[model samples]
Target: MKAIVLYQQGGIDKLTYTDYATPEISETEILVQVEACAINRLDLRARQDRPEVDPFPHILGSDIAGVVADIGPRVSEISVGDRVVLSPNISCGQCNDCTDGNENLCSRQKLIGFHTNGGYAEYVAAPANNAIFIDQSLDFSSAAAIPIAYLTAWHMLITRAKIQPGEDVLILSVGSGVGSAGLQIAKLTGCRVFATASSDQKLQIARQMGADFTVNYKKVDFSQFVLDQTNGRGVNVVLEHVGQATWQQSITSLAKNGRLVTCGVTTGNEGQIDIRKMYQKQLSLLGSALGSSSELRTIIQLANNGMLNPIVDQTLPLSKAQLGHQILEDRSNFGKICLSPTLSAE
Candidate 1:
């Protein structure tokens, strides 16, 4: 099978479209013929500096939608030719966290692309438990766009923050996949959504997506904007993932007793916070990881029901995945970048 394989981590030049051996699934795993795979910021960081446990000659894509080409002997529910998407997080089913329906917190959790080989190839294998059959109406690209970003957004707002209707919430990086999903999620609760972006064009789309207010962080100080808009009351919740660069400001933008949930630190780690302000405000700071399998199922159901829609901005063939990475790095695209593994010539 042909795949975009990286023998070493550094820049886009490390990725090469080449042939690799097809994986042999274990008794409980299934083989999927990759249709579409979504590019994420994690892919960018991985290319720059591969994470621990990542092996060389690695295939780097997390969210995927594909057809089941084969199933292992123990796989019962899934069948050949079923259209499906895999939940990126793999957890041991018998663990305490898994039994408690908190699979995202499982001690043995492994995110597909990060801890294992992923879907940036013509064919890939995954645990049968991780595959959720999708309705025929949804395309591979849209399905591929759901797992990581939407699940993370859903978990951040719905589970961790426990956002309620009429509450005010601020979403950072309104053009990001998570930001776009966060805007819709907040609107679903009838909450007033405040969004931030680096440009007018992205801010306009945020407004269209039901953001009550949009700020260009490049031009104005977003924390002050939030305070001014709310008359110094701040928002009930703040969805922050941009890490060190936005940490203190995100804390500053929160209302009294407000919840702040974060998933990633794209900027840099090691953010500082004022101990006095934290105690005085009585704020709740939470760290969110990839969501549970149940949350992924809910997002899938919502997508199937046409309530949730993932924004896939553009797609490139598997052979041209380097270009997709460049688009993400440059932050030029709005929603997501998809790769069609089937488009690669063998």
Candidate 2:
């Protein structure tokens, strides 16, 4: 199998496209023939340095949608030729957190692509239970976009923040995968959305997606803009994933008793808060990681029914994984960028 193998983490140039042995499935795992895989910011981070890249010659891609090519002896639920999307989170089912339905919080959880070889290749092996069947009508690229971006956004806004109808919500980096997904989720829940992006084009797209207010953060203090828009009350919830760069503003843009949920920190991780203001406002700060497989199933159902759509900005051949990483690094895309292994020859 041909794969983009990372011998060492440093630059995009380190990602070598070469032939490697196909992964062998264990008794409880299945081998998937890669159809489409989505590029994520995490891929870029792992490519540089993240400490989790193990066993050298690693393959990095977590959002995977593929066909079951081979099933393990113990994998009775999944069959070969099944159209599926692999849940990126692999957790110990016997752990307390897992038994309590908090698999995302399981201390022994291992993320696909980060902790093991991922979908940057023609074939990859995953736990059989991690595979979720998707409607054939849904394209592989679209299914590939759902696992990480949609699941994270769903967990943040729906599960963590617990946003309600008619409330105001602010989403940072509105052009990102999580940001775009959050926008759709907020709109479906009947919330008035405030979105921030670095460019006017992205802001325009947000407005098209039912964002009530859009701001070019590069031009002004988005927090002040949110305050002005909401008549100084701020939003009920703030979907914050940009980390230290927007931490203070996200905190300031929240209303009294507002919930601030964050998933990632693309720009460094240290942020200071005014303890007095936090207490006075009764603000809630929440940290989120990937969501449970059950949540991913709900997300897939929504996608299948057309209630939620995965916004795909573009598709690149698997061989051009380097270019895909570069696009994400440039932040030039409005939504998820996908890689199709079937298009590699093209």
Candidate 3:
């Protein structure tokens, strides 16, 4: 099997493409022949050893779409030759949170690539329950693009914020995978959408994705713009992922009792919170992680029906994983960047 291994995480040079042994699965797991895998900011941080790096020579990837090449003895629900998308969020299914249908809240929750060797290879081994079957109509690349960005956006806006039709929603970092996905999701309910990006090109793309109003945050105060657009009422919900850089403004752009949901901290972690403002406005600040597997299924269904779409910026061979990381790190890519172990699809 061919894979890009992180020998001693530091730079792109550490991600060396080479042949590695195929993963062996336990009785409760399945071996998937990976067709496509999507690049994420998590992958970049891992490459630079931001959090912590252990167990050297690891494969890094989370968003995976592939075919079941083999299934373990205990996996009776799935079989070989089944096409599936592996859920990136891994949790111990017997925990209380898992039983309550909130697996993302489980104490043992972990991301696939972050906690274990993942899908930057020709084959990946995952729990049988993690593989969600997909119909033949969907290709591997598109399925690979759905797991992280779309699922997080769905959980933030629909499940957490409870967005309603005609409400005003704000989406930040419009060029990101989550940003673009959230823009589309907000429009699904006929909600008025406000989007912000650093460049005009990204703002234009956001408009094409149904953003009602677009702002270049670099040149203008987006929070003030939101207030101006809503006649000082502010937006009903803010889909905020960029952490410290935009955190304060996101809170300020919200109307009274408005919801601000965040999933990532691409900027800096430690953000400032105004206690007085929070209490006075009765604002809701929510932190969301990976979504429920059920939400991923719903996203997949909508995508198959053409109501949602993956914004894939580019696709490269597994050997060129470093190039993909460079594109993402430069913040030059407009959406998801995917790698194909077998170069199966673009």
Residue-wise C-alpha lDDT for candidate 1, range 77-150, written one tens digit per residue: 99999999999988888998899999999998888877888988988889999999899888899999999889
Residue 200 miss distance in model 3 (angstroms): 0.8
Clash totals for all candidate models: 0, 0, 0
TM-score of each: 0.97, 0.98, 0.96
Minimum summed lDDT over a 10-residue window in model 2 is located at 337-346
- How well is each residue in 219-294 modelled by candidate 3, as lDDT tens digits? 9999999999999999999999999999989999999999999999998898888999899999999889879998
Best by TM-score: 2
Which model scores highest in lDDT? 2
Per-residue C-alpha lDDT of model 2 across residues 81-199, encoded as one tens digit per residue: 99999999999999999998889999999989999899999999999999999998899999999999999999999999998999999999999999999999999999999999999
* Residue 293 of model 1, lDDT score: 90
